[model samples]
Target chain A: GAGVSQSPSNKVTEKGKDVELRCDPISGHTALYWYRQSLGQGLEFLIYFQGNSAPDKSGLPSDRFSAERTGGSVSTLTIQRTQQEDSAVYLCASRNYNEQFFGPGTRLTVL
Target chain B: AQSVTQLDSQVPVFEEAPVELRCNYSSSVSVYLFWYVQYPNQGLQLLLKYLSGSTLVESINGFEAEFNKSQTSFHLRKPSVHISDTAEYFCAVSDNEKLTFGTGTRLTIIP
Candidate 1:
């Protein structure tokens, strides 16, 4: 079975530009989450989607960070007006029951 | 609010020596504890988790974790380590759907 997958393993963009990271969850997994891994901060939860319920956005650091899971499968994390502080590895994971399986993250570097 | 703390930012152990990665968590309610491992340029992999029924949980790769409710800790341990064990270990606690992670501990294996 295919595990969770993320696209654009690495991305480098201008500070003010917008970047979109994509994730494809495992089949039959209803829970998907996005997290940011930075050098100083380690790992920080960003957003989560559980089935058809409302996505948990409490972890989003700012208004410029948002994510949406469409058709209950694929998810995209969008960062608007990215800052140098936003440079980090964007990891995605999906869970069916308890343990979550993660994808190889997309490293975003805002230059 | 739920939070996790990994006291050691890094743990360097000799090959074939025992290693312990401490993880302490704080939550208002009961929580689920998990340990995850990440190699360089890779995603996280579930190492072990303590859910219910028992206080200890083991992973297939000779790693185990004990959930101590009174101490608010779920520390991971291994009797002996190998050179391949060099990676980052993260401890997380989940009270709801989203997990609160600690600043990971990087384990370096000394030859």
Candidate 2:
């Protein structure tokens, strides 16, 4: 069975640049989530989407972060004005009922 | 609001030795508990989960977790660990949809 997948295994961007990370959840999964893993921040929730309902954006650290799920399958996380503090591995996960499966993640490095 | 905590930042054990990774969570409602493992330069995979039924759940790889509602803990344990078990482990909790993850614990197996 295919698991969650993400694009651009690694990305290096300059500060103030905008970057986008993409995630493709498993087939038939109705729940998708975004998370960030960093040396200082560890692992933190960023956003979550369930079916067509409104996303849970409360975990987003700042206004610069936003995400959208299209057709209830794929998700894109956009960060405006990337900063050094935003350098981290962006992880994607999807769930059917209880246990969630994760993607390889996109490592964003802001210079 | 829900929160997860992996008390140990790192744990080192000799090959074929027993190991335990502590995980505690806080939530106002009953939640699903999960443990994930991330190898170097890789994504996370579901290690085990406790949604209902018995308080104990085990993974195919000989890892188990006991969910204690009163103690608010879902600690992972392995009777004997191999060098291949060296990786980063995460503890997560979910109330309904969104999940909260803890700072991962880096387990180093000394050969």
Candidate 3:
């Protein structure tokens, strides 16, 4: 069985630019989540999606951050007008019941 | 609202020595506790979890966590750690399917 996977293992961008990080959850997994890991902030939840219900975006730091999960499988986290503070590793995970499987994560460096 | 607290930011233990990583959580209702570990240059993986039935859970590895509801704590422990045990560990709690993570603790195994 394949585990969760994220694209663009590394991304370097300039400030004010927009970056999109993609995540492919495990098959048949109904729950998906996005998280951010940085030196300042250890691990912060970004968003969560379960089936066709609304996503829990409470952990999103600002309005510039948004995410969409298509067909309840692939998820894309978009950060608009990227800032130096946004430089961090973005991690994605999928849940089947209790345990969550995480992806390698996409490291975004805002220079 | 749920929150996790990992008081220790880093722990350095000698090889074959016992280690304990403390994790405490606060929530309005009953919650599920989990420990996730990230090795060097790797994605986070489930170390252990306590959802129901037993208050203690153990991973295939030598790691184990005891969920103490009275203390609101789920601390990870290992009798004897190996050099490969060096990594970052995160404590998370969930009440309504949305997880709240702690700052994470970096474990360094000293030779």
Judging by DockQ against the true structure, name the best candidate. 2
lDDT of 3 by residue, A1-111 (tens): 498989999999999999999999999999998989999988888888997454688889999999998898898999999999999999998888877788999999999
> Would candidate 1 be rated incorrect, acceptable, medium or high by CAPRI criteria?
high
How would you encode candidate 2's per-residue C-alpha lDDT over A21-62 as one tens digit per residue? 999999999989998989998888888898755467888999
Docking class of 2: high
lDDT of 2 by residue, B1-111 (tens): 889988899999999999999999999898999898999877888888888999999999999999998899999999999988999999999886877889989999999
Worst 10 residues of 3 chain B by lDDT: B94-103
Q: What range of 10 consecutive residues in model 3 chain A has the weakest lDDT sum? A: A51-60
State how far residue A72 of model 1 sits from its true place (Å).
0.7
Interface RMSD of each: 1.1, 1.1, 1.3
Tens digits of per-residue lDDT, candidate 1, A1-111, equal 598999899999999999999999999999999998899888888888987454688889999998888888999999999999999999998987877888999999999
Structure candidate 2, residue pairs in collision: none
Ranking by DockQ: 2, 1, 3
CA shift of A53, model 3, Å: 4.1
Give the alpha carbon lDDT tens digit for every residue of B1-111 in model 3. Answer: 889999999999999999999999999998889898889988888888898998889989889999998899999999999999999999999874777899999999999
| TM-score of chain A taken by itself, candidate 1 | 0.96
Pick out the ten consecutive residues of candidate 1 chain A with the lowest summed lDDT: A50-59
